[model samples]
Target chain A: MSVKLTDDVGAALVAAIVARSPYRRALTPMIGEITRIALANNQIRAALADVAIRSNFEATRTLGRRDLGPQRATLMSFLEYVYFASPAFLASVGEGPKEGSHNGH
Target chain B: MAIEADHCDVAIVGTGAGGGIIAHRLAKAGLKVVSLEQGGRLPDDYFSETAPPGAKLDFGIGPSTVWPADPHDSLFVHPLFADGAHGATPRPADGFRHFQILKLNGLQNLWNGVSVRFCEADFAGWPFGYDHLADDYSQVERLITVCGTKEGIAELPDGEFIPPKPLRPADTMIVNAVKSLREPFSHAIPNRKAIITTPGLANSCISTGICTSGCPVGAVYKFSARLLPEIAGLDNYELRTNAKVTRVLREPGAETVSGVEYIDTKTGERRRLEARFVVLAAGAIETPRILFNSADDADPAGLANRTDRVGQGLQDNPKSVLSTSLLKLWGHKRTYDIGYGDLLILMSRGKLPDGSDFPFIGHAIHGLPDVPHYLSGFAGFPPAVKIRMARMMFHSYVTLGLFCAGEARPENRIRPGSTTDSDGVPQVTIDFTTPPAAREQMASMLKWGRKILRKASATKIYESIDNNGTGIHYAGTTAISDDPSAGVVDRDLRCHGLDNLYVCDGGVIPNLPDKHLTLSIMALSNRLGRHLEERVQSETKVAA
Candidate 1:
């Protein structure tokens, strides 16, 4: 989950994520549990939010804003689909296979 | 320190699709443009040498991609992988995943030269749509001279394209079968390619099959040889090769960019380039890397990283290649020259129950001339069956090979981080697993591809189980963002918070449905160039 760049909640989230706040690790298990609960209740968006939060926490710790500094906008666009729009994405197009079998980049 | 004048109105990084177009447009508009290229400024003469894929790796940044010494830092160094040493292999991270993952370290290996356009349904909810960039696409096509016929699909864009290469006999046979099935399949033609048969060059390349080895003649629309010099002669442009830009120096709070820090590769000398604006076109992987490296204590999160979304949400085109063998026909020996391959493009979409379209897009079929011959040897039958295979061939039996490249949904993403490499420079760690939906699509396409080949009475079919990474076309991590949380850059290629800094590369693509991202990157840069021109003009008018 990317910290929404446009909102205060997002800005705070970005700060925490980029800073790798201690609170972030605590939210992971919490988000996992919430994701399960949300899925049981069919609240996909909520589940996705929890996942986003967890991802944001993780992203902040490793990549931080520095790595993505110039490309924050592009990275966020990718997250929108990852955190929120992925399910719908898979529904329409049949997921295809990876192009090459074993070469790594 | 020498106070040399190294200043320009705009500085563009890279010289491929993005930098090339930006230079072309900015120089044409009479702006002082300084384009920096990391590669050597080789004329047409240097490009005439033809080597194998691994041998010619030096033309680009990396060394000869020999096995074990994977000179290109693009692919991860691991045991049992290419390691830049051996033939390709299948390295699927998960067994049950739906889609096939091609194992090229980058996009270059997977591309079959099928050019495609994004569908309106593809960009349905995004900030912009296909029509918005139509004119820009036209500009890109003209600059690059794309080739293909416009299939009247509302979702796909058509343009002034070159005529596609003809289909080989083997491909024609498969096309007949697909058409006979009437599955609404349209054969793909290479959309926007660089190869042109020019008259005046001293060395004339006959369009041999070694496009991967770099075009021998000056026929291809390569960045260094073809586009850069043309853009440089515009008088408004000055190109600086072997100059590595290290940072986008900015003032304290606002997005106003002031200058750049770079190291001249030739002299190992560091210098500051003053510029009103900076555009980063350093491919996908390096673009984000530069951003992260540019971050300092004041910006700890990195220069434009207030949102912390910089290196997340990376993606790659979901790709698959199914190689099958054709039983031999009595009088046939298999051998195909570079240009004799049959190439066709595929474009059609499937709809969901809710009427919204899916992202499983298109594929192009190429290299049929080699497939039939290659397959006859791999029919997977015993030597005793040779007579039987021969008998089958008299009835027009032949080997068939087919590879399919499909689109990856947004969920399949990659991030830029490093692992402990033998060398300290972070080894790119890409964590991508094929999604189920895309897997189902590729499987279906394989079935369809096989079905088409079978129509020609192909006696032996072997879906290739061994292959490595697709070379050099990784994109979609740093895309144009509408919401700061969802993207890394704005629609105009600028970082959300930074006013004068921009990224124009494959990394800025929001989607990588097909591996044909070079064209779009070129188009986006062309658009960026136009925008820069307008800004410069506005500033000039105000000064007057």
Candidate 2:
């Protein structure tokens, strides 16, 4: 979590999540897909908790073979969303997301 | 051997928004003013020959930008320090925090051309009241020739204007959405921007659309360009380009500043220039760097650093950017240039999830132009998806960039580096820690930015997960206070113990909200000019 300014990969990943507005739009639909897939497959839901989110995104290409529907690209979007927009980041800042924190500045 | 000294009535350093306005006011008062700038002055036609952003960087200080100023250097630098190379200081001891320095001369032209005023509530920790600053704001408005419509918002006060840029198709949709929303669903209005529409003192904005790169014509108001012509005409004023000031000299026994020492960048000659007074307007980071580097036997810790607050209280609005398309504008498929002031301003207070009021957030919504056609050719996209992505480019996507008012903490600061710069002056390292209050604001802006975009019929909304503080509205550091223990500068913006020294920049601002700070810095500099005028006349009378 002690990311320095020079860490290009970390910075790019974070910027892709926050500054890129449509990416959050990438979230709502993807999360819905995640919910639907998790309800049907016990193994995928378990992997979300046990396997690292990065590893899960890589694992998604093979998710195409599963009976659970969604184009491979849509599945990739879901994995990317879960990896970047995770609630775990608030832990680094030492606070959970406060309600109504998105008020005007 | 004695160093040669050229004496002046007043000496000013730096020529950004703060220094330029001070020079304008003082020179107009007929006092002899000598101004020094580290970067070479851009010729009036510089933008015409070179692209606006690169004209100066080809020869001088480069901005890794505070905004989308050029296609080459597109994204705003994460912390405003991304491009540092020559004698660049290492990261600070507390490197994880927020801090960066963007001191480019005439760089204000690259801003969103915003002209916002801080409200009465935003000045809570300040020694003075909003009423006192109200008049100065008016004075600065007229000087800069700001143009905007008055909405009568208390937090975002009305200002002197020449009529704001009319809303584009996308902005109109957002405004219509705001009108339909529930009570204070964060209202939207045209931004009070420094860009002029009708010609008078400065040339009017021609709506050429590519302003952030530096206006090729005389439209956007950069303090350097606006006042340089008049200041040049003044017989008592002189502006020296490429003069890198290293330190403010204090006599071995004296409490006041004796003069300034600088190097002539062109000639590499070291020189001393003495004056009755010196103003450190190099900006918050460099201003403190100068003070800290002036550590001689007479003042070991640093000049005017008795309170240990010289480089403390560093700040910038905790910023967030979200992208979305306009509902009606996208249906129309209209092309936009984004050549006007901020399309809309968002202002409101929110009650947080933690059962407490969140720190205020203000947003400036600028219409994004067409997605660069070149992006359509990226080979990485699937051939089938390329067609869809190209069609999506027609959407009138807008970026709602939010700036949050954060409380200053002692841990947020910039300090002199272990080594010297190319000019032989110490470079600086920045460190910042968002206090709990400011952290609350960070959360507030992100949450609200997403909601507002969604309500406005936004599609493909991307909320920044890490991007914060690309805006250069920095403040604090040599903060003003009536009590020395509370800050480094006094109520009048004078250095606490150094009688002949003063600081006029964002550095003296004790409290900063998300409001744009350039106009306010200009107002404060004007006030400082009048104070110095009075003091000079009194001294003249005593001498007579």
lDDT of each: 0.50, 0.62
Looking at model 2, residue B537 earns an lDDT score of 94
Query: Model 1, range B1-544, lDDT digits (tens) per residue?
Result: 1123578888887666577678777777778888776434443443333222221212111222121121122123211123311111122354211121112112222223344566565564357887887788787776665556766756566776866544454555655655676655444344345445233454233444334434445445655545655665665678777666666787656568787777676677877888888998876655665676577666775666777666555554444444343433334432332241224554444343445443334333332121113323423454336334433342233222222333334544443343422212232334555555555555554555566566656654545321123424556657787787777889888888787888998777775554366667777888788888888788889999
Candidate no. 2 TM-score: 0.76
Q: Distance (Å) between predicted and true CA of B162, model 1?
A: 2.7
Against the true structure, what is model 2's DockQ? 0.02
Highest lDDT model number? 2
Error of 1 at A98 (Å): 37
On residues B1-544, what C-alpha lDDT tens digit does candidate 2 reach at each position?
1122388778899887788888888888988888887667666765544433321222111322211123223434322332344323443343533333333353564565677888887788889878888888899889888887888778778889887666676677666655665656367777677777774444666554445556656677776667877878677888877777888998864878888988888899988889889998987777888888877887787888877888888887766666665554443433343445255777655556678764454544543232231231233675345334434443456676666665577877767667666656677777765566655666677777667667677766655532223455667989999899999888788998889999988888987776778888888888888889999999899999
Top candidate when judged by TM-score against the true structure? 2
Candidate 1 regions exceeding 4 Å error are: A1-105, B1-5, B41-47, B50-113, B185-192, B197-205, B325-342, B348-429, B464-471
What docking tier does model 2 reach?
Answer: incorrect
Clashes of each: 93, 22
